[model samples]
Target: MTTSVIAATALDPRTMAAKGAIELRQVRKTYGDVVAVDGLDLSIKPGEFVTLLGPSGSGKTTTMMMVAGFEDHTSGSVLIDGRPVDSLPPRERNLGVVFQNYALFPHMSARENVEFALRMRKVPKAESRERAEAALDRVGLAGLGGRRPRQLSGGQQQRVALARALVFNPAALLLDEPMAALDKRLREHMQEEIKTLQKSLGISVLFVTHDQDEAMAMSDRIVVMKDGRIMQSGPPEEVYNYPLTDWVASFLGDTNLIPATVLERDGNLAVVDLGSLGVGRVRDRGAQGEKYAVSIRPEHLKFRTAPVAENGGTGELTSSTNLGATIRHRLSVGGHDLQLRELSSDAEAPGRRAAGPVHVGWDADKAQLLVLEG
Candidate 1:
C-alpha cells in the first residue's frame, strides 16, 4: 500500500516577480477566417513558470505555436525579452520546444537526439557529445544516453526530450502538454522535476495544458483562456481562491456554484441569501440588484450533529464513499445534489446502507460571491 503525503507551503513573493518574460500584444490568429486566438494580451516574466490553461480548442496551443514561430498570427506582435518577434522565423527565435507525443527520433539514441540541436547550430562533434551527455545527466538519464526512444520507458523518453530542449539554454521554453503520454504517477513526478529544473536553471517556461491540476501544481501564474481570448490570469492561489468570473471559478478548481441575489455590501463583504442555505456573507460584493454566484469548495463544508434542514442549511445524506483518508458524502440540498468531503479523522465513513438525515454546515466567510454579468 502507498500512502501519499503533501506538505503545506506559504505563498512565495518570488513566484510573482517571475511572471512576465514574453509579452503578447493584441495577438490574434485566424485559419481561413476562423479565429483561433483573438487579441490575446499576455505577459510572462523572466525565469518564471507560466501556464496557458484551458480546455480543448481554447487557443492555448495556438498561442504557444505562435510564440515558437511555428504558427503565424493574423495580427498583433509577440515580444520576447521586450522585443517584437512577429516577423522572425522559427530558427531565429532561440526558444526550446517540447511537444506531447515525445517527437523523438526512433532511429537515434538519446545522446544523438539531445545533440541534434547543437549539431545544427554548427557546434563541434566533441562539444555536442559532451553537452548532450551533460544534459542527459541533468535529467537523470546520463547512463542511458545510448538507448533509443524505443528502449526507454515513457517517463525516461520524456526526460530525454526535456533534456534536449534544455540543452540549448534558450531564451524561453515552450512545453505543450509534455507529460500527456505518461501515467498519472509518472506525470506527477515529471511535473515536479520540470518545476525544479525551471527554477534552478532560471529558465522562463510557457506551458500549455488542459489539465487544471497540472497547471495549478507547476505554474507561478496561470493564464486561463477561452474561445481565443484570455479569461483570467493571476497567481494560482489568487485564481483558485479569488476568481473574478463564474467561468474562471469553475475552470480552476472544484467549486459548488450556487445562484444568489446580493442583499447588501459593506466594504469587502457581501450579504447574500443562498435561497436555502440561509443568509451568507461572502467577499467581493458587487452592485445591488445584481445576481451573484456563490462559490463554495467541498472542504469548506462541515458535518454537524444537528439536522441541517432544521438549521436552514438544506441537505440529507444521500450516499457516502470511502476515499482512503477522506470520506465523501453526497447530499441532496434544495433540489441540488452536492458533494461534501470530510477527513477520516474528523468524520467516520458511513455504511452503505446507513440511513440518516445528515447535517452539513459551512461558515459564511468561506463562500465567495461573484457578481454575475449575464
Candidate 2:
C-alpha cells in the first residue's frame, strides 16, 4: 500500500466542508439534436469515493467532464460544496484531475512535472521545489524525482501525475479511467494504492470507469449509467445482488437469470414459482411489470444430491471448467442453459463434475426477482 504524509496536513473541517461536496442537479448535455448526458443528478460526499460506471457512450465520461468544467452543461447546475461552479474553468475548479493517459510532460523530470502546477499558481521557486519533492515522496517516489516521464515505469509515471494533482492540495480528485492503460495485475495494484491515498487524504473522488469489477473494487458507491442516464446507484453489494433491472444485473457481473412468475406477495417478500427450478420466495420491490426474472449469481448457486426444499431441480451437467479458485459448471435445465460456480476447495465440487446426474439449487434469499425493462 502507498502511504502518504497528508494525514498530518489533512485539510481542516471548513476546507473539506467547502471543497468536499460535488453535486449535479438535473445536469444535461447535448450536441445539436443528440443528447450526451441526460438529467444526471449525483452527489459525491466529503471523503467519499463514488464511481460513474457504464459502457462506451453511456455518458459516464461526459458527466465527469462537466463536473471538471471541461464540458458545459445545457441545463441544470453544477455545484462544489454548495456554491455554483458552472462558470469556472477547469483550472479554476480547484480539482485535481488525472486523465486516462497519465498526461505527463516527457521533457520534464518527475519533480519538474509535479512542480508545474505550483509554478502555474505563482508559488515561489523555493516553495514550489519543497512542495513538489514532498508530494513525490508522499506518493512513494521520493528518490525518482530526477527521472523523466520516459525514464519511469508506468506505475512511477502515474505517481508523478498524482503528485502533480496533489501538490496543489485540491479539494476533490477527478479521475477519468486513469488505470485503463495498465495490465490487469498492475491495474488492480493501482486500484488499491489509489483507494489508500484517497482515504489517507480524506478527499472526495468522482471516478469514471466502464469496468464493472473496477468500480466494485474501488468505489464506496457505484453509480451505474446507461445511454446518458443513471440506471442504478448504491453500495457495490446492493447494486450487484439486488439490481432493479435485468440490464444492471448482467452489466455488473455474471448472473443466471431465470424466468419467474409472481405467485404471491407478502409485504417486501414474494413467493414465486420458478417452473423447473421449483418454487421459492424472493425479495419483492413491488416492481410494476409483467416481465419478471430471478437473478442468481453463479457463485451463489449450489449443487446437492437431492433438490433443495425450495428452489432446486435436477439437471444434466454439460461441462465444467476449473477456474483457479472456483469451478464453473454449465447445466441444461428445462431447455435453458444455467451455470453455477463452486469454490475449488468444496468437497463436493469434484464429485459434481464427474459423469453423473447434477442436482442444482439456490437459496430463497439469494434469488432476486427483477423487472425486465427490455
Candidate 3:
C-alpha cells in the first residue's frame, strides 16, 4: 500500500477558503490489466456527508485513495473546492483521514499522537500542545490525552484518532471504514458522534463503508459501487426503495422481486403482468432491458385481509419466523415466494394476526419495476 499523510495546510482555519467540495471527473485507476476504479465521476458538496458504499473489490477504498492522493489516477482529474489537486502530494491536499485501524502510536500519549502532524510542520511547541489538547477535548477526551493507545478503551482510542485527524482543521475529512474494528454498540455510538461533530463544524466528509445500514443512517447521499463502477447514486431511501437494476435491488436491502412481463408503458409508470400476483402498475424509471422485476421491500409488504387495488393476492403462509422485535413471514402466491417483515408491535402484523391463509399486498407506489440486468 502507498503511504499518504493525514493532512492540513498552515493557513488559519478561519481565513482559508472554506469550500471543501470534492469532485472526481472521469477518474480511472488500473493495476496492469485489472481496473481498480473505472471512469468514476463523483462530487461531494461542502458540509455534505456523502458515503461510498460497496462490498469488497468494489473499488470504494481505491476511490478514496485517489481522492486523498495516495494513488495516482490513470486518467482524469480530482478537484478540491473546484481547484484541481491531481499533482499535489497527500499532505498538500489538506484532507484529514482516518482508517479502519485507529493507527495511533502505541509509544506516544494520545496528545502526542494528535500533536505529531503539527510538530512535523514545525509549529511552536506551546501552540501544538494547546491545539492538541483542544482537539482531544473536542472529541470528548478532555484529560485522557495523557493515556497511550494501549491504555485507552476501544471507543477512547477511536476518539483519539478522530482528534488527531481533526487537529489540523483540514478542509474535508475522509474516513475509510473507520469503525470496522469497533463493536456494534461502539460503532453506532461513534457514528452519531462523528455525524454530530461534522454538522457542528460544517465540514465536508467522504466516508467509505460496506455496511448498508450505516450508509443509510449517516449519508446525505450514497454512491453504490459494484465491479469498480457506480451502480446507483441517490438518497438512501431512493436507492433502497427504487433501485434501477436487479443487482442494486439485492444489494441495498431485503426486497421481494417478482418477475414481470412488461405489457405496456406510459411515461415513468408501467403496467406489467406479475402472473398469479395479478397485473399491477409499477414505477418504471426508463430502464432499458428485455427483462424486468418489481422490487418491494419486505417491510413494505403488508398482510391485507382483502386484496387492495395494487399488487396483491390470496397467498398461503408457509411459515412464520419470530425474529424478536420483528417477525418474518414467508408467503407463497402462485409458487412465487415473498418475504414479509412486520413489526411485532403492529396489531395487524402476520405474527399477531393468525397465519395460514393470508392476503399479501403492497401499494403500487411501494413497488418499483427495475431492469433485470444479466
The best candidate in terms of lDDT: 2
Q: Write the per-residue lDDT of candidate 3 for residues 172-221, one digit (tens) a residue.
A: 98999999988898788778778867776778899999999999999999
Higher-lDDT candidate of 1 and 2: 2
Candidate 2 lDDT, tens digit per residue, 200-275?
7778999999999999999999999999999999999899988999999999999988889989999888888888
Comparing 1 with 2 on TM-score, the higher-scoring candidate is 2
Q: After superposition, how far is residue 329 of candidate 1 from its true place, in Å?
A: 1.5
TM-score of 2: 0.94
lDDT of 2: 0.85
**CA deviation > 4 Å runs, candidate 3:** 1-17, 307-310, 347-355
Which pairs of residues collide in model 2? none
Worst ten in a row by lDDT for model 1: 1-10
Question: Highest TM-score, which number?
Answer: 2
TM per candidate comes to 0.90, 0.94, 0.92
Better of 2 and 3 by TM-score: 2
Name model 2 segments beyond 4 Å from true.
1-18, 347-352
Rate residue 237 of model 2 by lDDT. Answer: 87
